[model samples]
Target: MIREQATDKRTLKTIRYDADLIVVGGGLSGVCCAITAARAGTRVVLVQDRPVLGGNSSSEVRLWVLGATSHMGNNNRWAREGGVIDELLLENLYRNPEGNPLILDTILLEKVVMEANISLLLNTAVYEVEKSDEETISGIKAFCSQNSTLYDLVAPLFCDASGDGIVGFQAGAAFRMGAESREEFDEKFAPTAEYGELLGHSLYFYTKDTGRPVRFVPPAYALDDITKIPRYKRFNAQEYGCQLWWIEYGGRLDTVHDTEAIKWELWKVVYGVWNYIKNSGQFPEAETMTLEWVGQIPGKRESRRFEGDYILKQQDVVEQRTHPDAIAFGGWSIDLHPADGIFSEKPGCNQWHSKGIYQIPYRCLYSRNVTNLFLAGRIISASHVAFGSSRVMGTGAHVAQAVGMAAALSARHHLLPRDLTEPARMQTLQQELLKTGQHIPGITLHDDQDIAQTAQLSASSEFILTELPPDGPLLPLTFSAAQMLPLPAGPIPQLTAFVTADRDTTLTVELRKSSKPFNHTPDVTLETKTLSIHKGKQEVDLTFDSHIDEPQYVFITFLKNEHIQLQYSQLRVTGILSVFNKINPAVSNYGKQEPTEDIGVDTFEFWCPERRPAGQNMALRIATGIQLFSPANSLNGIQRPTNQPNAWVSERNDPNPALTLTWPTKQRISRVELSFDSDFDHPLESVIMIHPETVSPFCVDEFVLCNDRQERIFHKTDNHQSRSTIRFAQPVETSSLTIHLKTNHEKAPAALMEVRCYSVS
Candidate 1:
């Protein structure tokens, strides 16, 4: 409410703020967007309409923060998201294992406030937009109802991470609402006819036992009839949290404009459902349970999707397309729901996953119509089908991270959002992201200033890759195609495969080089071998004269024969991966019984029906004469193990083991970052419902950093974090650096992902 001091221009006063970036919304994506830009030295103004942060994942909504790992249930193989969100997840894992939404709200708020470059405005809703033109948003006017203050926020660049694209809509940016027709984007998942109905919103409630008999009296709005509810049979009194993501509504109406109406409907459904559980004759065990918390706000699924230069389609995700300017990656299934939501008689949602992780181009992050505006989170440029996959909070966090880095780069270079899409600039942006521990899946970091690339790398111990660890049950790889695997730079002696043939048959396995490393497509056949196998489970071996001179790729392909089947492991392998036939129809949740390998696990092309012999390699192995473990492997830019377990360890006999990196010339360094082993092989659950007897810990307890002159520049005697960064007060020049470590209390051997040094510019 702005009061005019006087009619004359001389008596007018205004409250205004200027920042490098303005982020609208305090959701997970917006929080990451603002924090990333601010951390990279950009002034940001973060505006959230709610007093509490974390839009959908807040206490008001209470949706779990899901990402590529998919709650550690989807075994997409080493697909956890890193960077700012990773830090939050790791911290939450340590602090709030119970997965309390209130704790998460404090975590998000504290993260935003700790950044000195960010100005946070909670309970402020931006309703007015002042644009320089149709193509640029110059500023915005927001009202903080709590404080009764009017805010004028101006910035060079703006991001609409509000999940509804409100800023982009106000700025007149091109956008689409609801679902598209099948022919629109040639999307198989789209509806046959174009419809205005979109995926609905969800409301959740938490119920806990009071340790004694409790009675619940239905409120006036409580639902009475249980026969109308189709999912009543699926309800369990003990279930809470995101297990109720399907208690949704309001897809038939505008999710944004009719939010209040939708919330009311959701509230009715919630209380009604609870009444059926406690008051209805069907439930007796719920007598001791009482409603603890229920959501006032609904967690939305889809609304207005802003148009970018390129719109991601279902094919892009299913095909796992690798973009030239890929800035992010998503692995969640393409999950879409019916417009009627909970009212729909059919299943609530349908989903389809990719063969492997897919890439998200930078072109899909900024607006095609609004030059100065950027978009992240659920509102990014994607068709409804594509949005189904990228809508998850973890994937949205990745999108926000890219937008933040791009915002920082744009602010520093005096370039617009679209201008940063140039190849060189985009590459630099990717390098910066990787430097900050955001894994881009396919992209490799090449920093010329990194002295480790030219240093004489030596470690006290190295992890030797001699045999494959026990693997999960194998399925038949009988399709008329082949499976692929990558070999280290070493010699290959005899290739082995476990198989059970219906009859005596000859099997041919070809070794080739992969043309595309991301897709793992075999290009040329380097060697071929044919072996005869019997009917029972037996070991089949083929000798090949192939030697990998450099860190190149070697793809393994087994000629398809219906009678001949390749034997694979029954136990799931943690860090190693193999690509199976692409043309074969995907088996949804092939091995759902295994907790570590559940639904969305089949998204990767690594499953085969053939079972491997016990104590044998899962599929194949090499008695490489060449050394697999060396100091050089640590700085090869391959951080997390995807296809193989890679690391350098010290000899067990050595009294003092350390890794020393020495360069030819001294270099100015400002920061040293270390990524230690977090036991990627053993999976951890985000929502722990059942307490386990033991947990695996992978963080180093203590470490010391010394320069070439033996002068201690940084030392941490008490470290329990997976990723650690030591920034010197001022840049220190050094030719060599060494890390002395104290073994973890758990007695697990020391393992690391990467050790990187950076010169702050």
Candidate 2:
């Protein structure tokens, strides 16, 4: 009877889902769009074709999650995708330093399930669209292969986050594919003639070392001649994960329509490469190695780019144009790969670095022909040349975040997706994004509803915290690269860095500054110091007298010495960004190389020696030992933590520390939000990192809130969350309020993220 019941339930059944917004696709962009909308009080139904959520970055494809940082590439100094993407990257860095894809899959799923407003349907692929008119998309029909069920999902607005823009294609939206001519968009790097040829698909494999020796034999289908491929020399049995991103195929055909064919071709290449590594007899190290895993699905690079009110062009990216309606920013270079992919005689790809980070306008996120359709991810409005840069997962995530915010606002206003064209509505969307810690270049947060800005901040005591754990492991400071440090506004006598040198050698250090706070390159040398350094475990100090009136980026160059290594930290804080410069043999920036112009630094293709995980900062500290961490920092409108490590920390053994907010006149407050420092190193993202599983002892355990004469007590049993919102049953009218807090686990020096007061009626 039970088996019969199960079998009957598995039979095909028709179901209907009505939501405010329908997100098609479960990639990073789709997940971000759905989560952001759900958080903003919109009913969202997230439809994913695959069982996992990360798309290419999942266990199936195993591609590294990359963004505007471009693997810390050149000209992308201090650039990171904000909003939901930041949380995901931070969580990944904290939990999976090894970059395990299976762990990441759980994180993405947990993020979706945690949201109350999101209804997720996995293993469901949408195959049909219901159009109300030529411009409107009324609904969609999806089939679930696992359950044998049909779903009719209806929504007022729709987001085409599917990498191939499947929904838009079915709705008859205008789109472009492949490459365009240089004359069409006036892009210098574009093809002389137009063609619909795209970048290809890639398959990756992982290998593991068995305790004992292992043997492998090649199958008949394996490539006998490995010499035919140019990259065969670099292949080793131990090379695994995304290192094989270059093992690409199927660029000569449609990347979306001909996906299965491309995937099979990639499979043959993977087997061929593995056979060469194991049977070529050239690598003795492979005797104990075995193929652990190989990706079945190929990670597709380029596909359909839908048409919107605005099409991002190559000139817009190369010139670094700022849009008036800019909602997100991207700093990756204009990277264009040949249509021939691996078979091409040319280098794998060509990249043209931009002057600086460029803005992505709001108009590019929604369809112009399909009225109710919004586009996210690689499907957004862009010329083929521009898509080359925006197609990156990180940049695409930002695009999705913007679309999600817009969808929420549109649903609330009962308007079409295009209704966001009005300045008032767009400002509301941008402000909401900023409240959630998303940074938009050229935009400042000035929301009047936030009570933190109105209060004068004071603390019980200010003390220097020198006992912080290293952000992560320290990396060697090579001779070719120089680190850029961000300094807060204050006077300093000296700076200190943890270092080690193989032999006694003098280290030259120079402090340079940039005119724009948003830029990464330093222009003027404020001072220079040379220190006689020791061989090992040395704390080097460079003494200087300087005062910065405002927050500034100071570039410190440690001239390369083979034996010398400077220490670094993975801990990230706001207003502080750490970047490095490397020795380049061929370089010309802004027309000249000698006495090089700092502006040209933006054009130099920069590459990080290792993966510079998002939200990392240098380990350099202030030698003066004066406490710089202030409670006032919590209200400075800077939510992102950079290397400087923002947040207020109480002094050791301090008694009765409290943060008080006062208003001259009585203000009605209905809610209070508290942000805690649950190990700033552990960043929150779409996926959670598993390491550092314990909660930070520095979190406040108990607190009493006094709103003038009325007092309320709240107790925190656990201190695991980074953010907490407390809503009073009734509005409290008060001229002043104070939060008296006690540290958890008897840990002294309590830390707090931010205190946000709101009156939501």
Candidate 3:
């Protein structure tokens, strides 16, 4: 191995040392790579140039991390890696309660800090690379901003996760940029053969709410003469924000050659466009929003792709290809931005393959010329057409994870990554991935003696209810306020449930409170249950109850005998009645009063059908409170106006309580609703206590509300809800909150049916 001698004049002093792998970039791919390698027992040194991580999908770019998961509708085979990615989703769900940037940054930072085997270096840039001849990378020269000193990181393997493929390019690895002619990859979307123009870059920006209005002002380079460009005609407020406009490209020559100039021109273009919109009086509300963020560096979408053992082609993507050595999967459509300095409004600007899911082979992830260097993320070896489909940051994250895992395995086995391409070794890697919750298509592992004994269930079922498992560590029992009914003398429970629609549905098991008056003592008790279901099949219903309203909220509680942590693989709820009560009460009566004394408690409850697929288990808990009303006094009570429900609420001194239930798998809930007693009055304000498992520490699914009139209203959480309310949104019904416990922990209260005064008539 070749080593670089530290020179006295280098101005860079070594601050930290010793890591099994040193990932050079702190972007999404680099973060994923570091975390994965660390989780697999490798000490990782993660160096990031920016103060924050997440790169493009960060607060700086304001871009969402789209994936081929159910949430984004791609549902590819490799959508099963749920370790750090899952944690990120949950963090985003909690922090980004409003889906904002600061929350996203917090989530990424949390992941980096929480990992035990990873050392994060922020505000550090890798300016030079240390290599062993032309084949192996030995270490990287990193600069720390605090001391203005340099540090050397030595690792067996290095990943060039930088979108620009800087490490590989500097190491003399073979790489290509732009597009080869259609004749090269036989791609339909390529511009006429040969190396052609590449996609331009953009400087993204954010908008903030300034109480005062501000006018838009054009930048120095704003091209006011859009008369020659027809694409400008299609531009609208919906597409153009103060920050995100591809207004200027090719004005200062090649984007790749003169990126700094391109970035400068793009900024001017953005401000100039905003000026045009303001000066032209195109939008009256334009003055209300101020520029929240302007890009410091242009987010480049296309760049050099390092050549590897296998160059993934468009045909492989079109064929729904699967490979024995497949390490990762990508499912975004072939999205090709214009390279000719002219925007295309054609429908085919982004191309799509007939098959959505595509496999990325392991051979394409490593350098073909460099013996030891590996590449992941957007810099992987692929033809231009194939890169277009796999360049998304989320997909790149998955690739980085797979590549990291492969690298770790190679180091442990004393073998190169190329050796793992053999079928048997690939199978071993696949098995290791599955063990860590990474999803591989057409792969399954057996932990038991009988394969035919797996439980089967339906995805369209209205509800699943069952008694807590009597024994076994796989499913623990919890006894709480709700009662548990034993399973009937049948293969499955004898619960009767049906659905009117035949679409896919989800079944959720929860511990809920029965509708009743709240008292000081605990009056409800429940037992936890363990049900079993097959991986993908939804079970048929034993029967149906027509008397039950559509979109109803179902609640059932699982009792925890001990503090046992549970995780669910999947959950779904369907055919449950979703009720929204708009109760407008006269808060003027309580205006001048010092606020009523602690009122009596209220209760709501739902049943857990005693029968469910065997081996299927769930978790349950409770939260309670009531929305108090006071009109003029924002100091004493949480209040909303009579006309608008979306305004803010004030919490005087009292806060509510919350309870969380964690399950065994990532599942979808079928039905959810709130409950209220007859003593409750209208102009109902605030959801006091909600007990959906979705609000717990694990799950992060989005919730929507539809009233009896089929009208939908989106819910936003306020300060009161953040500190006092149990769950942000009511699931589907009002009757399930009464059966759970009402703890006086200053945060728990009885559940409320609705806060608004208007009915859905």
Between 1 and 2, whose TM-score is larger?
1
Off by over 4 Å in 3: 1-10, 69-81, 192-196, 209-211, 226-229, 233-257, 340-348, 446-761
Whole-model lDDT, model 2? 0.72
What tens-digit string does per-residue lDDT give for candidate 3 at 116-227? 9888888888878878776788888888787687788887877888888778888889998767676776665565322245666666665565878876665657766654
Q: Please give the CA lDDT of all the candidate structures.
A: 0.72, 0.72, 0.49
Q: RMSDs, each prediction?
A: 6.7, 5.9, 20.8
Tens digits of per-residue lDDT, candidate 2, 1-761, equal 33453343454699999999999999999999999999999999999999999898788887776665554444445466666876676566556655678888988999999999999999999999999999899999999999999999999999999999989999999998878776777766664322226888888888888978888776776666777777678787656767666787777788888999888777777888888888788888888888898888899888899999999988777667878788887766666666666656555665556645788999999999999999999889998888878888888888899999899999998988778878888888778887775667767667788886787676776646443234455556663344454466876546677778888988888776654555554555677788888888777766767666676556655666777876766543323345555533212122212323322213332423222243235456665554556887667554544434456766666787677788877878888877665443222222212333334444565667777774664445444455567787888888777877776444336666578888645
Against the hidden reference, what TM-scores do the models get?
A: 0.82, 0.81, 0.59
lDDT of 2 at 360: 93
Off by over 4 Å in 2: 1-12, 73-78, 92-98, 191-196, 463-509, 523-551, 561-579, 582-602, 605-630, 641-658, 663-670, 674-753
Worst 10 residues of 2 by lDDT: 586-595
